[model samples]
Structures are given as structure tokens and as C-alpha cells.
Target: MAMKHFTIQDAATMYGVKEWGYGFFGINSKGHLEVYPTRDENLSCDIHEVVTHLHKKGIRTPVTLRFPQILATRVTELNEAFHKAMKEYDYEGDYQGVFPVKTNQIKEVVDHIVKAGYKYRYGLEAGSKAELMIALSMNLHAEALVTCNGYKDESFIRIALLALKAGRNVLITVEKMTELPLILKVAKELKVEPLLGLRMKLNAMGSGKWESSAGDHAKFGLNTQEILDTVDTLERRGLLDSVQELHYHIGSQITDIRKIKAAIKEATRVYAKLVKRGVPLKYLNVGGGLGVDYDGSRTTFHSSMNYTMEEYAADVVYTTKDICTQEQVPVPNLLSESGRAIVAYHQVLVVDVIGLIDTTHTKYRVELSGQEPQILKELAYTRDNISVKNFAEMYHDAITQKDELITLFNLGYLGLDDRAKGEILFWEVCRKLSRILSYKSLKYIPEEFQDLNKSLADKLIANFSLFQSMPDHWAIDQLFPVMPIHRLKEKPTLSATLCDITCDSDGKVEKFIDLKDVRDEIPLHEPKSGEPYYLAFFLVGAYQDTLAMRHNLFGSVNEAHVIVNEDEDFRIQQIVPAQTTDDVLKSVHYDPDELVEGPTRRRKISANSDANEALKTALTEQRKLHTYLEMN
Candidate 1:
């Protein structure tokens, strides 16, 4: 039989590359995955070349590739989209975006965003004191605004006041009524007029997994009475001008466009009311909820958004404009803290497959002697009689016979050898049934055999730690696009689940994104004995890096930053190597130097030269080795 052919298009479609890739990632004619820094340019850089380059430089698998060009492009795209919308709608308000530092917080990622967004006068949003410190240290442009959010102590308030005094555009958003008094006291002590904003708890809830971030029962934000009291208190204290911004966060990863429209309309109404009350609300901060289509379904699914960036900008601008016009209030400056949408596409995690555990290796017939157990003979008979027409019935019979054999063995009526033979026969029957089911149409397959493929699929053991790299997948069931980096031109004949190197059983990625639903297995090529196969997880730049944990003492992996030059040639801008064993030990409060010294001291005290030499060699090896598996 002729080998089935698979093209790059097939790989792209199977992995939803066109839907989620945003034209930055695709398969090239060389049968290797490529990254396009600019979609309009004809130049492209092969990812395999980047991996090979890193390997030659002593970096191995389980590495993350960071493309700063993609981050810059996304920032430009977002600013341009809003600018175009404002122009088309003829809105007078200016659009300013703040990168939420909590999304990544990595020094390199934050530095790149600051550099990329300089042209747009982009700002930063800090949720905690540490984040605020990072934001304050950044060399943001003069016109950029730095918004301080989340719960704050006196120190946090003092820091914001200090930043305001430093000639920075700093806004402190009050989450509760009590926070206003603290901010006022801090402002008086510092002798600086603090810029204050209010986070209103809107009744319009968001959509998708993070819907709890908004609505009436949200964890943060004030109610209607609280808002009125806040304004009243500010007026009484004669600090009403301090309240310059009104902010509301519907949620994160909001999938429905209608929910956004509703939230914007309601927030606009509140803004109009405040404007009528003689409050100088100059900034309308629409907190981040912009969604990324991780699965590329383009529906109201949790992993996707139904609206485009253009539509989102238009809706937000037009809704605010229409409401402000009706209320006869000046349109406020627009601010969005969209961190996920800007950073999700810039990083890709690549892992290497170590080996595979095939479960369908018992397809051959199980030899039986005439003196075997009656139940074993019955199972063999069912396995032999399984045809395309009677595969389902034979499968049922085999299962029944196997169960009986197990019960007999437990009751001391069947030998261990007989039970083993019966188990083999039962699996052979399932293998034949799976083949027959594959020949039948999807709809015609029996419900009993629907999960046969998943049960029989191979388990591909990969050389990465799921808890250390992609924790959201295990914690919140977040789906990421996964696909093989090479071998796109060859058809994948094996259905497998990716199992990470972590010892915990929860380290396996079994649920994969599909067009209509989640799939149980990912299609992959059969593993070769002496070759390496790599797979990449896409859209992981947003939260994975910061959210990774040290479970099983598996520290962060190696990272490579790639810069695409004007001529489309890729350069290794930076290579952050993975954590060594000694590094991880130090993190957990283990003194590596003391550990080596104590053992060596004891060996020397005993006057054992061989023991001392062995300890020295062991210590040297431990300090140089990484925590992850070093594949041969």
C-alpha cells in the first residue's frame, strides 16, 4: 500500500494555526515550522534552525522561545486598531493602554513591552507593591500613565504618592471607601495632590471562566451606595478633583462580545452621571478582559472570542461616545489594561518526546493449550470469531469472559497463567474491534466502542515538567495549542497523550483543543529509536512564565530570546539557561556548599582518600547537571 501523504496545510488546519497563529507561525516548504516577524514580508525564520542553534550552544530540550518582534507587532496592532476606530468614529478622546505587570513580570518581557509601546505612549499597571516598584523603575515615556491597582497598605499608598511627586502620571484606584481616607492622609503627609480613581462593581457580569471577576458579588470594587458615598466624602473633604478616573473590570478572557457591550454601556452611564455631578472624570479605564482565541474556534467558547480586535475597539469607542454625547459630557481619555492579548503569542514552549508506551501491542493471537481454563478457552473463541459484522458482540463476550476469569482467579479456581492468557485474548479482541470501528463511519460506531481509541492510544513521554512550565493547564484546565514542530509532510499514524517528566500522574496533558470539543488524544508520528521529535505549545506567553511552580523541585527551564532582523535573519538575542541541580537545592534552603563541605570534612577526618575523591566528583557533577532529564 502507498504511504499516505500529509502536507503543511493539513498540519496547519489540524492545529488551528490559521485561526490562532495570527499569521506569525506556520509550516514552511522545508517541512519545518517557521515564524514570520512581519506577515507582509516574504522573509521567514525556521524554528528548527533556532532549536538547532540553541542545541549547538549547549541548550537542550524543554526550552522556551521568545520572539520580541511578535510582542512589538501585537502592541502596534492593538494601538492601531484603537486609533483607527477612534478616527472612523470621530471620537475626541485619546486611547492609552497600560501593560499589567502581573501578567508576565519577567524583566525581559517587561523591558521589551516598554520599548515596543514607547511610540504609543503606553503605560504600566501595577497590582501589588512589588509590581509598582518594577513599574516605577521602568523608563516610561513622559506622557505614559502608571495606574496602581489591588489592595494597598500605607506603604503602597506612600509609594504611589512618591511616584506622583516624581512628575509621573500616576493614578491610584480605590477599591473600597476606607482606602479613600488612607490615600488622603498619605497625600497630606507627602504634601502632594494624589491622582485617584474608583473601581465600581458593575451589575453586568462577564462571560467565560473568569466571570467572577466582575458583577455585584465581585471580590473587589464598591457598590452603588459606596460610589455615591465616595463622591460625597471627596466633595466634603474638598478633594473631588482627585477622582479623575472611573475603572471597572468585567473579567479576564471574556468570550462574549455582548457582555462587553453591556458592561461598557453601563460604565458609560455611570461616567455620565459623575460628569453631571460636577466631578472631573477625565479617564475611563476599561479594565482588561480582551480575549485570545487559544483554540481558534471564534465562538463564545471559553477558549475563544466571537469578536475581532477591530470590532472590540469599535464597540468600546462607539458605545462610550454615544453615551457621553447623550449626557452632554466630554468624552474621557480611554485606558485599557489588556495584558493577555498583547503577550500571549510571543512565547512558545518546546519539549522533546523521550519515548512512547503503546497499548495495542497484543493484537496477535494468544496461543492456548487444550488443557487451559474453560473461561480462557471461551475468551480465545470470542477473539477468533470477532469479524467486522460481529466485532461489537464479540467484544462484549470477551469482556464477560475476562471478568469471569478474574472472579474465578480471586475465588482460587483459575491459575495466574490462565488469567494472563485470558487478559491477552481480551485485548486482542479490543484491537480487532478498534480496526473494524475505524473502517465504519463515525456516526455508525457503537457507543460502547467510542472510547476505544483513547483507551488504546500510546502515551508519549515528553522531557518537560508540566507543573513547572504549564501550570494553568493542570490548575484551571486552560487549553493550549500543541503541535509537532517538524515532520509536517509526513502523516502521523499514532494517537497519543503527552505525559510530562514529573513523577506525579497529574503531569499528563490528556485534553486537547478541537474544533467542536476537547479531544482525548493528539495525533503524533511513531517514535524512532535514535531520533528526536519536538512539540511546541502555543499562546503561553501571557501567564505561564510567572505562574510556573517548583513542584517536584523542577525549576524553570531554559529560555531563548530570538530577534528577527530587517533581512529576516534570526539572531539569538539572549539565552537564559535552565536551573541547575545546585540552583534548585539552594532555592529550597539547602546549602550546597555546606552539603559538599560536610561530606568532604567527614571523609578527610576519616583519612579516607578514595572517599574524599568520590565526594568531590559527586559534588562537581551535581552542580553542573540540570533538574530535568538529559535525553540521549
Candidate 2:
């Protein structure tokens, strides 16, 4: 028998992949992701080997693999697309993009963005003072614009002023009327004039799950009245020329292109008005709201978008230029804060399947003891007689028998021996019945067993911490593409929901992305004999790494950076190992030093011991040494 082979193309199709720009994952002649699992004539790296390598290195259970080249490619593509749009549209404006630090604050991720984006002079957008500090520290390009947003206090304004003093061109966006006064006071105290901007609350609403992020009643930004008031305040302070930018944002993951055009028109009109009122603004900061095609539908749905990156840039530039040109205002430098589009496709999370529980792989067998309970016999009969057509009926009958058996045992009507038989019999029947109803060919599943479907959903024990790898799934119900990375030649036989190694019940990803509701189970292939199976989670690069919390005491996953050079040999740049038991304990304020020393003392005192005691002491010392080595 030949072993079944699966390729990356198989996984891409299962993900409903559509070419948004370039291929993130595609099938090669040998299968698996384009870079990993390269083609070999007879023997090649399979998903099993890829997973086993990491597991052998002590990077098991959960890991996030980040490809720096993919991130660089995504950033390059976005910048090039917008520039191409500018040329195609013949718009007089230029593209100046900034990565929002709030999206993903991982040091390595931010460091790479700053380094790789040097040619494009890609800037950073900060939403808070702490984020502002990071942006200022990382932004080596003096020409790159560091735009500061969010509600500001004296300290926030002071930091922005300090950034300007350091010779970095920092734009401070006033979200409220009072922030203008704070900025004025801080700038004067610091003896440095700050470049100012205002976030306008546009009347045009955006489309998507976060539509309220930019409209009239949005959480942040200034209303029409406040916008006018800020202009007067700046003029009164003799800093009108310092107010060089106007900004607005509808929301993130904005699906509708029309809303973008409307937002541009509205913000442009405000920009023109600011110029007419003697406010010398020279830039327009269209805040972050760029959408990502999470579902790959590409139909203007909330989780998806119809417009391409080029189309988006052309729309913004032309709309702003057309309106400003008509109003006789010069086209300001075009700026956009698009964090999702720049970083979403750069990271992938790889997890391994440890085992699965299946009770229906065997034929019906009856085990009858002299003291066996009567209900156990009935359950055995239910399992033996069940058929696809009568599966539901048989399941109900078995449930009734199971209840009677439980009651009989409680009342001492049955013995322990009978109770054990009844328990096993009932579970086997339930499992088998569930298998029947959940068969793919079953035209319709009865409504009464909907909850039962979830209860009996195939339990695939994957080596991962869902909360640590994909926090958005647990925090905001954000869904990403998930599928097996191999075994295309063989068809899937199990409908499985993945469960992580975490002890918390909520650590499972039972609900997945679907058109109707969160999915119950995804199709999974059976592992070939003496072979292992693994799966990969895609599109996890944006905020997952930085935002992941230490839920259930699980630390960050082991991360590797793969760089594809000219020869196509992926050079593994850096491999940051995951936290050890001691590391996790220290993060929670526990002094692992004391806990670590406990073992050494215990080992020295085998002052009196049998072989078993000596063996236990040696094991304790080995465990402590392992923990120390991993942490270091």
C-alpha cells in the first residue's frame, strides 16, 4: 500500500483561498507550503517530519512560526500597489503609509518592519504614549512621519513635543478641544513647536463590524463643532502653521469601498475648509480602517472586501485630489495607517495532532457476565441493530435504557459489575449512534441531536495553546483559516473540533469560521499506519503574537524566522525558544530562584535511601536542570 500524500494546494483550497495580491500558500510539485517540505523524487519532508523536528527540539505543544520574508513581501506589495495606483489614476498625491504599533507590538516584528521598510520610509502610528515611545525609538528614518493619535493628556503631549525636539517629525492628532490647550502648553514648556493634526468625526459611516469606529457618534475623534473650535484655538495660539494635517478613520477591516470614498470626500472638504480658514495644513492622515479578506469571499462582506489595494489607494488619492483641486486647495501629502493589510499574512501557526478518540472503528461486541445488568444487554442490542436510516430512533431508545440502568444501580437493583458493563455499553452506543448521524452522506441531521453533535464532535487533541497562539479567537471571536497541511490523496473520514492542551474548557476552538454559524467540526483525514498527521493555522501574523495572553500559564510559542534568499534556500535567521516552567512562574511574580533551589537540597539528603528514593532524587535534579537550561 502506498502512503497518502497531501500538498499545500490541498490546504489552500480547503481555506477557500482567493488571490488577494500574491500567493501566500500554494502547491508545489511535491506538496506542502511553498518553502517548507520541498520536493524530493521519492522521499520528502512530510507534515509529520516538520512537526516532529520542532517537538524533538523541546518546542512542542504550541508554536508560532514567523516568516520575515513573507512580512517583508506583504509590506512591499502594499506600498508598490498604492504607488502603482497613483500612477494609474494620474493623481497628484503620493503615498505615505505608517504601521500602527498597536496592531502587533512584538519587538522582533516591529524591528523587522522598521528595517525592511527603510527604502519606502514606512512610518509608525501610535495610539498611546507608551506606543508613541516605541515608535519614536524604532523609527530611525528622520523623514518618516510618526503620527500620534488617541485621547491625550499633559504627559502624552509632552512626549510628542519631546519627539519633535529629537528631530523626528511627529504629528499629534487632537481628539478633543481640550487637548489643543494641553499641546500648546506642553510645546511652549518644552520650547519646541509640535506639528499638529485633528481627527475629524465624519458624517459618512463606514461598513463592517467596526463601522462605528469613525462616524459622527464614534468613540473617538472630534465632531463638527469641535473641529471648528480646534482651528480657532490653534490660530489664537499663533500656531496655525504648525497644524499641518487633518485626519479621520471609519474603522478597521472596512469592507465597503464606497464608504472609503465617502470618508475621503468628507475629510477632504474639512481639509479645504481648514486651508480657507487660514490653517496651513499640508498633510491628510486617513487613519487605519483597511480591511482584510478573512473569509476569502471578496464580496464587500464585513469580514471581506471587494476592492484591491491598488483600487483602495486610487480611490483615496483621486477623491481627495479631485475635491481639493476643485476647492482650489493644494493636494496634501497622502497618508494612510493600514496595519492589518501590511502584517496579517506574514505569520503562520503550526500545531500537531497527538491523538483522537473514536469508539465506532470496531464492530458490535457483547460482553455478558453472570451479574451483568439487563440495561447493558439492551445497549448492546441497540448498537448491534442500529442502521443509518434508524440511527436517531435507536439512539433515543439507548438513552432511555441508559437512564433506567443508572437508576437501577443507584437503588442497588444492580451490582458494580453490572454498572460497569452498562456504562461502557451506553457510551459505545452513543458514540456509534453519533458517528451514524454525523456521516457526511446523512442528508439531514435530526434537530433533537444538534447539541449531541457538539457533544460527540470528534476530539482531535492538537499540541497547541489556542489562547496563546490565536488570542483573537478566544477574546473577540475572530476566526482565521485552519486546515490540515497534508494528506490530499486520501479523503477525510472524521469531523473533528480541535482541543488545545490547556486545562480550561474554553481553550478549545469548537466554533470555527462559517457562512451561517461557527462551525462544529472540520473534515480531517485518517493518519496512515505508522505515520503522523499535523495541521497549520494561517493568517495569524497581525496581532496574535503580541496580544496573546498567558492564559492557563501557557507562555509564547517558539518562533523561527525563515528568510528566502536569491537561491531559494530558506535561511533560518532566528529561533526564539518558548518559555519554560520557571519562566512562566517568574512572569507571574513568583521567585523561581527559591523553587529552583529546592531540588538541589532534597537531592543531597539521600542521607538515607533505598534505590527508589535515589532514583526519585535524581529525577528531581534532572527536572530542575532542564527547567533552568530552557529558561536561560
Candidate 3:
């Protein structure tokens, strides 16, 4: 037998980097994961170096690494794809995109998007009052559109009206007919003609998890009759001229391009009908459904998209052009709130493997003094006779004998020693079955042993909390690509499942993304004691940060903003430290001052000896420390 050696290319293929990374991520010859900011550049930045630098600077494990260069690149790729599509189709109107702030409301994330997307005049889309305030604070380009979406109140409408009066291209989309009067009233009070848009509830729906964002029974948007009634009300008031944009969102993370094309055709027809009624709609806002291929399978799965950005843009442009030309209406300006597509690749959640738990650590062989139970002897025989050729039959026999051994022990016929031997023998059989299943030449694993890998996988306890980092995986079963950041040049011989540091039983990631299907476990190398092994969850920039919860009082992890230099080296622009114990207490309406003062007073009253004083000092230091576990 010969030991097979694996290369960096094998790591790339195993992790689906070429498909999901979109050329920004790869492994270098040094076995470190590298970030290539630009496709034309030959230079690369090692992600391991970034982590090492952060560690040197006192930033611990479970730090999020933000690559602003990737954000800029994605924004450029999205806009350029549309621009190329418009040119090829000879489309009359231009393409405009606004990032929905709800996808990631972090100030740094929004700032990076605004900075990177300036060339494309990319703007912000606010779905709430708080989000609108953030959007209004940004100094967007003069031509950039500020889209005000979601359910609005009087204050929301007033703010939108003020933004419009301030010469911003603000579009207040009416989700329901009830919102139209609020816009009109706010506009009349401010004596400013507001830019109004209607979000139509299209009959055509999108595909994937969020397809409910549109369709007849959607949560937002006005029905056909409600839209007509609103239009008539505006027309009677001579305010139909204010209706300058038509908006419709099929869903978020739409995986199928055909669904996008169908939605575009339907929305364009709605735009043409509105124009025929003398509404003079100039903007057709195709609300965001642009998806990222998280699994990199290129299939129409919930986790991955079937089409490319260029294909999406081409279909959007050509469909709108064809529909408008048939209806003899002008090609309206195209606007998309593609938040997920723009930000999904901009951040990676890095966590270190603190330790591994091996389930098959116990030796199975037992010393029998010729007085062992018949059932225990049979289980031992099955374990000894287990081989690849007869693993299935031997496993079944072991299971039956183990069950009989447990029954005999409960009936007082077998002693604890015999029962222990039986259990060990069963686990040894499982271990041998898993080893046989791992043969490289094996094509298909039997259904009975399909879960053998999961059973034998090493449970890697990670330092990060799943609730605070990847909420989608916990809440919606979303798959994020997780891979080792280093040791790519070596072969990963162990299958592992990641268990977070949280106390909740649900705080573990067992499902992983694969090229052809979902993987039950991730391939990982055997951890060397006293050495740090790091893994990263990729394409988590969208909806993760904002959606993270404070489960078990675990707050936000430390964040490192990495900027790529001209020489392709990296620099940490900023580091946001994780929340302290006081921060978590304050969030839950606890007074930190009162807590500290009470603890101090109690310590003083109870401190009569040197040991008590030392305990008080230790308690004070513990109170100031962060909530997460500190790795030794």
C-alpha cells in the first residue's frame, strides 16, 4: 500500500472555490488560502497571514475578515454585466442598482458598498425608518436613486419627501394603497411634489427560498385592483405625474433565471399598462432576487443559482426590451435592489478548531475469562470477522447481538463487564465499516451505511457561536461553504462536523455544501496538539450580520476589515472588538454601574481574609472580560 499525496488543486476542487469564489479566493502553493483581489493581477494575499497578523495584534479566534476589495469587485461585476447586456441588446435606458440595507446594516459594510459602488452610481434601499435614516445620512452620487420601500408611516413619508425636496432621486414605493395617501399628505404638507412608485404584486413568482416576496399572496405590494384604484385616486388629484417608477419584487435569492425572465416580462407589461394610462412611469424597479451560488453547484437549488450575473442581466435587458417594444412603450430605466449578490462574497467568518472529539477512541478488544455471556462472545466474534466483503452482514449480526446483550443485562442475566464488552464490540464494528466505506475506489456507499461517516466523524469544537455568526444555517438550513484556511497541500483524512461553543443543542453545523449534493461532514486534517487549525465560512456577507441573534448572551464577534494593497498585500483598515460582558448586560437593560457597585460592596463586606480579597479581584476581572471562551 502507498500513501497518496494531495495538492492545493485538490483542496480547491474539494471546496468548490472556482465555482463559489468567482476567482477572488484560491489556495497558494504554500498551502495557505489566498485572496486575489483582481483577476488580472498575478500577486496574491495569504489569508493565513491576515489571521496571524490579527492574532499578533491581540484579536483572537472567531474574528470576521472583511475584504472590501471583493465588495468593490462584485459591484463592478454586477454593473458591468448589465452594462454589457444593455449594449448588446441596444437597450435605451440605463441600469441602476441600489443595495437593500437590511441585507447588512453594519456601518462599515454600508460604507464599503457606497465607496466601491460610486462609479456605478449605486445607492441604498431602505425598508424601514431606521434604515432610511442610514441611507439619508450617506452622501450618495447625485444620480444615485434612494429607494424607500416597505410599510411606511407618517414620519417615514415625511423623511422621503424631505429627501426628494433636497434634490435626491428618492422613490417612495407604495407597498399598499394605504401608503399612497400618507405620501400625498406628507408631500402636500411639505409643498413638495414627491416621487412616488407602486410595488405591484405580480402573478408571476420567482424560485427558491424567498419566492414568497412576490406573487398574488405576497406579504408586501398592492394587488392589481388596489394598484388601479391608487392610480385613479392620484389621477383625480392631478398627482399622477408624481408616479414616476413602478416596483415589483419576485423574491430574494432567486435561483432560476427563467423565473427572473418571467417576472421581468410581467413587470414590464405592468409598466407599459401604467404608461398607457398616462402615468409617465420612467423607472421600472425590478426588486432584488439576485442570488449567490453559495454551494457553487450551478444548479437551481435553494443554496445556489443556475445562471451567471451576465446571464441574469442579459435576460433582464432583453426581456424588458422585447416586452416594451411589443407594447410600443419607451424602455424605462432599470433598477435592482440586488443586496445579496453584491455583499454575499465580501466577508468570511473565521473560527479556530479548539479541539476534536473522537467517538471511536475506546479500544474494542476485551479479555474474556471463559465465563463471558454467549451474546457478548458473539458480538466480539462479529467485530473480529468484520471486513469490507462482509461488513454489511457482520454489522447486522453485531446489532442483533448487542441488543440481546442489553436485554440480558437489564434482566440481570449479564454483568456490567459483559455489557461493556458488547458495546465496545459494536462500536468497533462501526469503525471498521466506516474504514471500508472510505476506500477511494468505492463508487457508491450502501444506504444502510450512508450515515457511517457522520457517526465516525470527529466533532470539532469551534470557538464561535453559531447564533451570533451564521443564523441562516440555524434558522433556515442555509448552506454556507466552509473549508480549512491552511494545510491545503496535505491530504484531509478525517471527516468532521463543527460544533460551536454555544450551550444550545442546535448550535452545530452538520450539513455542508457539495458539488453534486449536500455533504454530511466536511473533510478536515487531523489536528496537531498545541497547533491552531482554522476554518472559514465563505459567502456570509449578506443577511448574516444583521440576522445574528444574542442567543446564550453571545454577542457579536471581533471583526477585521482587510484592504488589499496595490502590490496585492493586505492591510487591516480597522478592527471592531467583540462585545464585553458589560455590553451584553447593558443590552438586556441591566445597569453595569449598579452591578459592579453591588458586587464591589458585597465583596468588601465579605472580605475578611487574603483569600477573599483575591477572589474579589478575580471576579472583577472576569466581569470585564468578553462573553466568549478565551482560548488557552
Candidate 4:
């Protein structure tokens, strides 16, 4: 039989992977995010080398690279997809999307989004007064919409009205019934009537962690009674004409397609009712629930969505068109605040794999002398005699002996050497027992021993921090697609958990994406000699970068923007260095000037004793390095 040779594309194109490559993302020929590369020639740029270069330049541990080209491609694809759907459905409505600033508020990211979307007039969504200011300041085209959401006070409403006063197309969405009165009061006091939108509390609920964010009893939005009161108040004040848009967010990462149809129908009815009451509504704001398949599963999992982008667009347009036409209402513009879907695929967080623990090291192996200890003999027996039929009984006996050995060693009944031998033998036995049990019965395997798969498991030390860079994963158990940047040709031999360098115990990912369950880590191939190993976390552009916090004073990671130029060459632009120790201290109101003194202040005039001589030499060295003790 002849051997078949396959390139990275060919392997990635196999079976279902090819569809993900097209619909989701792939490295383009210019080393950018695209459907696939232009050709094999485009694979010349090494993502791993980028990490190594950054690490060598003192940008150690974790670093996030923002690819502006990918952001451009994402904005383009989203617009094109919805536009194509409109054409296919014979829809009369125009499609517009806004990048919710809450998803990611990084300056470079927002700048790149605006630049890429200048032709399409893609706008920004704001959930706060500050975010509205940012959106108002950045949106270049007057045709784009500046959407204001979230809880609002007088100042927040006042600023949004001011944005409208400045000729910006601002839509202030009333989240609560109370906000409506405040919004009306602010607009009347300021004498600026801005376009108004209402986020309705629909009866339909989405499925995800944020499912509770909507529905009839949602935290935000107006109920049926509240909606009627709002309409009455508007009619009385002659401001009903300002109610131009109806918005509803079932949830973020809505996995169920049926929920989409239901929510749109519910929201569409609300729009129709408002229209029936003489409130002219011209827009349907389907607030940001278009989910991404984070787990690559076409299932209704919280981390994954069941429907495709085309299906999602079709549902939104078809449902709205049907409801509006049936009610004899004009077709409204379709607006989506799909922050996650828009920005998720636009960025990849590439972090290097520092090192791994070799579980098979000889130092961890057991070598028993004559008259072996009871725990060692039991371990040997467990390793040699434990089978699927007797695994449970042997495991119990081994555990008992293990506890006894540890207790004896702590109480000085056993020697240090014996304790070491006992632990090694017990671990060897546990590994073998786990292997035997996994085949016939894995249910009995303890959670602590679940890492003992037959395949060699390597602990991967990632450069990124869970608390600092990927807080959502640490906080909400959100799973992102992670894979090696290179070495696609090699089969991975090890599966291990990723441990971040944070002092918090919750800073590790124990669950990773697997066939049956979300796992803590994926299998990784061993590194070739002198070659740096790296893995990239995909679909992290939204919310992860800006929402990251500095835990344990670890500081933030360095960031760089990667752009694919018109010549199809990749270039690094706008490198913002990470904060230094002094800089971070200054941020927290620490005055470095007050705590510092010159080296001459610490010098002793009489240095005859040995201690004085040593102190004088230490002071000289510290002065050379520009370091000083705070005590001075």
C-alpha cells in the first residue's frame, strides 16, 4: 500500500473540520484569519515564532495579539451574511449591526472595527454613559446607530440625548419602566427629543447561562402592564412618535434555534402592539444573542449554538417580515447587537507552553529492597493483581493501606525513605488500576484519579493567566476552542490540565472540550528539540481582552496589533508595553518619590567592622541597579 501525504489544509479539511474552517475561521495565506490560506506559501509565517520572539523580547508568560485584519474579515462576513439573507428572503428591511462596547472596549479593537466597517456603516452599542461617549466619539458615519442600553440614571440619559443633539443617530433603549420616566424627564428638561427604543420583556426565554437576562420576569425590560403604561405615558406627553425601535435580548449564546423563533415572534408581536397603539416603530433591535459554536458541537449546549449563521439570519428576517406584513405594518430595519459573534472569531489569544511534568520520570518510580513495606507490597499487588472484576475491592484495600502509611510516616512510625517508597508504589498501583478500570467500568474511578488515562498525560504550563486574561473562563466556566498553532502533522500524546501562574486555587482549567464532556485540557504533542511549543485560544476577541483583571498583582499582558497589508504582508503595529512595577504602583496612589532615597543616605562614615563593610558593598551594588529599599 502506498502512503498518503496530506498538508495542514488537507488534514483540516477532513470530514466536519472543513466546514468549521470555512464557517468559523482559518489562518489565511497572509497569516491572517480567513476561511483558509491563499496557498501553502501563506503558511510561511510562524505563529509560534511570534510568541517566541515576544518572549525573548522580555514579554514573558501571557500575551494577546490583536489581528485587526481578522476583525475586518469578521465585520465584512457578518454584514455580507445578513445582507445575503435579506436578498434571499426578499426582505425589504435594511440590516445593521453594532459592536457592543461592553463585549470588548479596547481602543485599538474599536478603532480597527470602525475602520473596517466604514463602508458598511457598522456602529457601536453602549451599555453605560462612558461607553456611549466612546461610541459617539468613534462612529464616523451618521447613518450608523449608537444604541444605549443597561440601567440608566439622569446623567446617562442626558448624555444620550446630548449625542442626538450633536446630530448622532442615537437610540436610547429603556430597560426598565422607571428608566422611561427618567428618559422622558431628561429629554424634556434638555429640550432634545432623541429617538427612543424599548427593550421588551418577552415571554420567550433563551437557553444559556444568560437565559435569565430576558423573559417575562427578566432583570431588565418592561412587562406587559409596564409596556401599556409606558405607551400611555408617551401618548399623553405627545412623545409616542419618538418610540422608533423595539429591542429584546433573550440571552447571550442562545443555543436553541426554537428559542430564537419564539423570542422573535414574541418581540415582533410587541412591536406590532406598539404600532397598533399609534407608536411608529421603524426598527427591530434583536439584542445580541447570536451564539457561536465554542465547543464546535452542533448541539444546544450552553457553550455552543445549534443553528448556523444563515439559519439565524433567516429566522430573524422571516419572522419579522411575516409578523409585520400580517399586521399591515411597514417592514422595519433589522439591527443586531451581536458583539460576541462579531468579535469572537476576530481574535486569537496565542500563548506559549512553558513546560510539562513527565509522570514517567525514574525518580518517581518505585524500587523496593528486601522485606518490602506493607504499603509497597499492597501497591505491587494492586498493580499486578487488580483486574476489572476485582478493581473495587483492591482499590479499597490499597486506599486503606495508603492512608495508614501516611499516618505512620507523620507520627514517626515509618522512616522518610519508606514513606517515599510507599507513595511511588501507591501511585503506580493507582495508575494501573485506573487503566484497568477505564475499559470495563470508568464510573468507579475517583475524580482525583481521572487524569490517569492510558495515553501519556502531560501537564501544560500556559503563559496566559486565568484571572488576568481569561476571567470569564475562570468565573463562568466558559470554554473556548484551543488547539496547537503548529504541529498539525503530529499526533498529540498527552492530555493535561492547564495551570495559570495565579495564587488563586480557581485559576486552573480542569475541564476541556472533549467528545462527551467539557475537559480541562486537550492532548498536545511533545515539543521537538529547540522548538517552542505554543497553543492558541480562538474566539476570544469578545469580552476577554478588556474584561481581564489584574489578580495577585501579576499585572497585565503585553498587546500588539497584527495587520495584513495591501501587499498581503503581515506587519506588527502599535505595541503597547505591559505596565512595569513602578507604573502599577503609581496607578494605586503609591508615591515612589516619597519612598526613595539616594544611596549616599545609607552609607556609614565609619566602616571598620565586617557587617559595615558588607553593607557598604551591598549599597554600592543596589545603587548600580537603581534599586532602593522602601525602609529608607
Computed on alpha carbons, the lDDT of every model, listed in order, comes to: 0.89, 0.74, 0.87, 0.72
Q: Which residue runs of candidate 4 sit more than 4 Å off their true CA positions? A: 1-45, 52-61, 357-363, 387-392, 437-458, 526-531, 565-569, 594-632
**Model 2 over residues 1-632: C-alpha lDDT tens digits?**
98656545554555454343135655434444443221122222233334455667665535566666666766777788778877876777677788999998888888888887878888999989889989988955768889998887888888888979978889898888778777888888899988988888898988977887766678888898888877777778787788888888888888989989988998899889888888887789888888877766676766578887778887887788789889997788888899988778777787767767563333344577645555777888887788898887888898899889989988988988677677677767777777787679988877887777566557787777888888888887777877766664455777778888788888777765554445677777765555557677877877887787787777777777655544334445777877766677778897765654555454665546565456555554643331221220
Give lDDT: candidate 4, residue 51.
59
Better of 1 and 2 by lDDT: 1
Most lDDT-accurate candidate: 1
Clashes of each: 0, 4, 0, 5
> Compared with the true structure, what per-residue lDDT tens digits does model 3 show for residues 1-632?
97767888888998888888888898888999988866545756889999999998889878899988788888899899999999999999998899999999999889988988888899999999999999989978999989999898999889888988988888999988778877888889999988888999999998999887678789999998998999999899988888888999998899999999899999999899889988889889998998899999999999999999899999999999999999999999999999899888889999988888766654346756667778877877887788878877888898788788888899999888777777877888888787788888788877988887788777889999999999999999999999999999998978889999888889999999998999999899888888899999999999899888999889888999998776658889999999988788889998776665565466546436666557557656866777788885
Task: Judging by TM-score, tell me the better candidate of 2 and 3.
Answer: 3
- Can you write out model 1's per-residue Cα lDDT over 117-189, one digit (the tens) per residue? 9989999999999999999999899999999999999999999899899899999999988898899998999
Backbone clashes counted, model 4: 5
TM-score of 4: 0.86
Q: Candidate 1 — which residues are off by over 4 angstroms?
A: 1-4, 360-365, 369-371, 411-417, 440-442, 566-568, 597-612
Locate the minimum summed-lDDT window of 10 residues in model 3: 598-607
**Weakest 10 consecutive residues, lDDT, candidate 4?**
623-632
